[model samples]
Target: MSERFLTHQVENQPPSLLPYDAFSTDLPLREALAREGGGWAQAQVQAYGVLAGGEMMALGVQANENRPTFKPVDHYGHRIDEVEFHPAYHRLMELGTQHGVSGFAWRHADSEGAHVARAALMYLHYQADQGTSCPLTMTYACVPALQQAPELARDWLPRIVSTDYDGSHRLAWLKAGNTIGMGMTEKQGGSDVRSNTTRATPIGDGLYELVGHKWFFSAPMCDAFLVLAQAEAGLTCFLLPRFAPDGSLNAVRIQRLKNKLGDWSNASSEVEFQGAVAWRVGDEGRGVATILQMVALTRQDCLIGSAALMRQALVQAWHHVRHRRAFGRTLSEQPLMRNVIADLALESEAATALTFRVARAIDAGAFDEGEAALARVITALGKYWVCKRATPFVNEAQECLGGIGYVEDSPLPRLLRQAPLNSIWEGSGNIQCLDVLRALQREPACRAAYFRELLAARGGHVLLDAEILRLETLLGGDPTQLEGQSRLLAERMTLALQAALLIRHGDAAIADSFCQSRLGHQHGLAFGTLPAAAPTAHLLERAWPA
Candidate 1:
């Protein structure tokens, strides 16, 4: 790609209004897409653009008389951006009942709403640039419907999975594939799959009927669904197709689309099923495990998608700091401004490094029990931290922009509203922290092994010494003696473990060095200790001794 394409200034306008011709020679994106099997980058960009356009539409950009048709009203009456058009929203919705209620339910009520809105806007920009339809959209929508009704899975799965459809006027907007949209939410349950009240009973001839009301049917209008129902065996997953084999409405009915905080372009519906035709997705009682497959994928995607947005926000902030001036100098020249930038850069890089490390682990086929559990915990941490940091970083960037940052025209304002959703999406920070603790407590040996491996990867002696010293200072040299005062100590230890894992597994050596060096600097400031010989020793050990 040309230098211009690689660092092109994105306009604040809705993507549909942009000229696609300018992106024709964008080699970098093309190369990236090619690396991911020729069409991946294009699809990612397209999905991003559609997501962005959807957000713009919700923001009244293309509305008649410049007034939005659907105001931001969530199920709880909070004002938010339209969130339905977001791919993440659909992604989660499609998983339906297969996912655990605790994490998935919280995601729907909190973060998924914003993700959908932002993803819609991002996809809009991508589609405009790529001049192509997003394949993931419809597929994302259909999976949920398929999951709810297995009979529809056979028919709809082929239509949406993998992009071979030849139909004209194709549902370009509906780009996802056929996978069960697991509908695990229940009206009486409190975001816990174990607490589901809906029931499914076996009637003969390979057919099971379902009766339940799902409160958050994210993409209820999709082709199929995976609905969760309680049976004598335990909580079970059932596939519910939206239409019969002849393409008519099945027993499912839309109760209503939710009013939400953000991403309102698409629908987050509440639905009712009266004996909906469905089939089981795996074993009858193993719904949690089966659905977790989809949930894990979605959670990882949430990290990537949110990180992508954070990258965008960071770039936007960088541009502002470099160009926007105040008090006779550029904002980037100010000491306080530089500090803010530095802080955000460190946070962004750490989050990105952790995300990629987890992705690579998944790619390497390292999903053993220990690895899978750790990945989930790390994913949750990454999501929470990235999402948590992004909003403030954007806000700080906006602060640099002063009044302009607060305006609708400024990207920072939108980013500020959009970024917070990430921390809440997939799972809340508290929930993730608890999961990390649970993993550490429940599988102490696994956790210790994982930590030991991380230490070895970072040069065991050095990491161990560094961590011990850091902890000693925090715990005042004795953990047992500081039991009541160990919360902060525990938190630091967790962060240290997280940082070590990322450093040992990340792709870029220079980046890792920079991170470690930065951490060393912080440690020196906090503990008043300098590693006089460690850096040289570490470098020498990794290099050939001459």
Candidate 2:
């Protein structure tokens, strides 16, 4: 008898389907964009989708896998204090800025669907890579703050909005296009930016000399940064450059790079400013006002980013489970697996619906105060709820893949690690919840605008109506009592808004199931506890067509 007997090893797996058009295949995204604004700048969105699905996806993987390295000194023993990255990282940066992912809305502000279309493109790009988005997002948001000082903006707006990705570390004016970073949080003061101790002494005119350390200096290689520091007029906003106007390197020293839980492809540093060259952006005591517009824009991107992460996780799970089989049946045929997938799909759709709607509101708000007020509340609301849901949603999706999902090689691990970042990036859950309360308490007109939204879907569904009634009391409650209930209020408000959108535009199956499980409380706390009324098969099929 032969001692070596061969056992059959099966390779039943889903082949890599990268380079597919993420835009065309994503059903909910297409519908949401069309409904929000019909004449979207579609060519760019489609092109980004192509890159996101194909070569860009691969580049994202390679970049993150080979994390950037810090170089304190170059070959000549000079103190360059640089962060070296793989060529793949540079390629991803070029791809993003080249396609106007960072500056599309600013450059095309007149386009009716500019905000919505940019949101769509950003949604696609987030699925490809999370790390590269840091600098890109900051660059886009910095536009609004820069507008606070038009004279200062005149010198840099053209460079900021340029679609080219000039990765050179030269002066901002010397580059074809420039990237911007931010430094608000110091070691002692985190989200408490009001307590920032970075000192800024006036150097004549609006210029200042900054001497302080930023706990988190994001995208260390960027040509410029929008920073917060203490000035003679209290906390103020300043623009700190990497190189002086005369082309010599500024006094920005990279103390060290953070070994983060995720976002490996990007470099975040602890930076020290020893009399760095700076220019004040706005009035001395009005730094907070200038920061608000930029932060609001960034927070909206956080909502969109979470939605994209959820979608990416679902796609990975759907592909793996549909192909792999055990117990003489494909995993998709399993009842419990089917329920989980359907539930995940529903949450993702709900998030997508709200994200695009708010983007439409933000675009509309340019000329309407009521719309602007509405955007303020909804943006904070969506940011909190969507970011909170992302981690759990991605975790369940990863579980659907079993042991293979836990491995480093699988994309799930990366998605899993990246999931919590958005929740913390612009602001944590508490910050977002409190901000919603701030909207309701300080801005009655904003509350009224939100109420108008709630009333639009009145009598359309009993669950929605009941939830709206509850939200009314919360919104009108005393400010002191409301702070303790911020989380609960935010969850209810966000769900109510999502339910309204689903009922108006989503399929009957998704809408009915969401109301039953979320509002009616027909099931337990965990997912997959869907009530019998759920159109499970239809939901799964719609979420991932054959």
Candidate 3:
């Protein structure tokens, strides 16, 4: 059965699906992040699924096309001119354990908290097949739909929440993972989210009717949507299942998928819901808070993904320079190339440090109101800097490759194109900056505590002196002081201070001072410092001089 399914390709072509093979490689921390996912991010899904035993489930299923026969190429080709179609393909097979390979379902009950883990695995498959980028919309839709019809949550959560593959095969295409990205963006809403124009009114029976269009949904063709709509009480969340039980498109229509620079593997679409059947997720007025929990998770995922991308770029650069020769020796031996590689390595490590630290904080439940706001702010900064640093590293790596890098076939250009999308997706850098500012304003005391943590981390005396000097310098009214008024400047200042504190106090041992210095330079960039030839001198003189 597994062989037959493995032989069954998408259409007549063999499967291009790569199994998660490098789960146990022990590379340097930063290098591992890049090679494992950052550089080859699309492959991370398989790794995640394998970790949760999803490969076993695939193995258990009989070889057959049980779902709808919709070709993604037909839908995508209309929008994208260039589409790569692999010739030979192979589906995901059994998980190879130390004992031997086994079907996915056989190992389903093996892991601790296996049920939840299984749901997560299923979710990933669904996301991969439908669209990977639009979990936000699907989550939003599911919460409300389940709340209104509690039975749906009870029935569906067990099957689909943990694993993306367990849902009804008939409605597989409409599940969270199957759709085009969910559309939540409105022309005027701008992430404030409370200002959406879409409306839902209670009709007859248990269904409420929906009407409105979303401007930017990641997976618009998803099985169901959790939409935000104006109601009699206030802005509320509605779960609009996109298809009937028989697997037909209901009232939702896909307007189009955006031509994006990154995450092109998934469709980012605009959609219209016309009298779509929906059930409420929670109390109408409490939609914002409920949605935010999901948004926070998405933000963390973005940060992790960005950090992974940075790691990938750095590793690729290292490998390129190590093997590629120029002049008389390897590019890595060149003084300038060495410096560039060192700098890239440092930034990647710093980004990873920050990301993992935040993840631990989240896991520890340290994200109180104040910490939550700051975490988001810091994560935004991390996402922005990791990707921002990665782009140049990729370009430099390509430069090392010279003409070969310029060609599309090289991974350098692909990394360069894909890395920038991280900064834009989740939330734009500017939006993150604004969010930080808002957070600071809302919790001045907590903001102050956060800064104190920063100051203490940078050596309290040193930061105190620097802050006083900075204030004194600004009293003379330098033109650059105008930048101090910008939200990003203030937020990044807080981040720098906090990072310095974390380094001083955090348990992670410093492996490379060269990496640390490069991180300092990157931090300066995050704070919008002017480019300088000597990064150490610039950090002392401009960023946090005592």
Model 3 misses residue 342 by how many Å?
0.7
Please give the RMSD to the true structure for each candidate, in Å: 11.4, 1.7, 11.1
Q: Compared with the true structure, what per-residue lDDT tens digits does model 3 show for residues 467-487?
A: 534533442365444434644
Q: Pick the candidate with the highest lDDT.
A: 2
Error of 2 at 446 (Å): 1.1
**Model 1: lDDT to the true structure:** 0.47
- Ordered from best to worst TM-score, the candidate numbers read 2, 3, 1
Per-candidate clashes come to 89, 2, 42
Compared with the true structure, what per-residue lDDT tens digits does model 2 show for residues 156-223? 88888888888765677878898999999899978999989889998876679999999999999998
Candidate 3: regions farther than 4 A off: 1-152, 164-169, 172-181, 188-192, 204-206, 245-248, 366-374, 452-484, 494-498, 505-546
Query: What Cα-based lDDT does every candidate model obtain?
Result: 0.47, 0.88, 0.47
Best by TM-score: 2
Q: Estimate each model's TM-score.
A: 0.64, 0.97, 0.66
In model 2, which regions exceed 4 Å deviation? Answer: 1-5
Ranking by lDDT: 2, 1, 3
Query: Which should have the higher lDDT, number 2 or number 3?
Result: 2
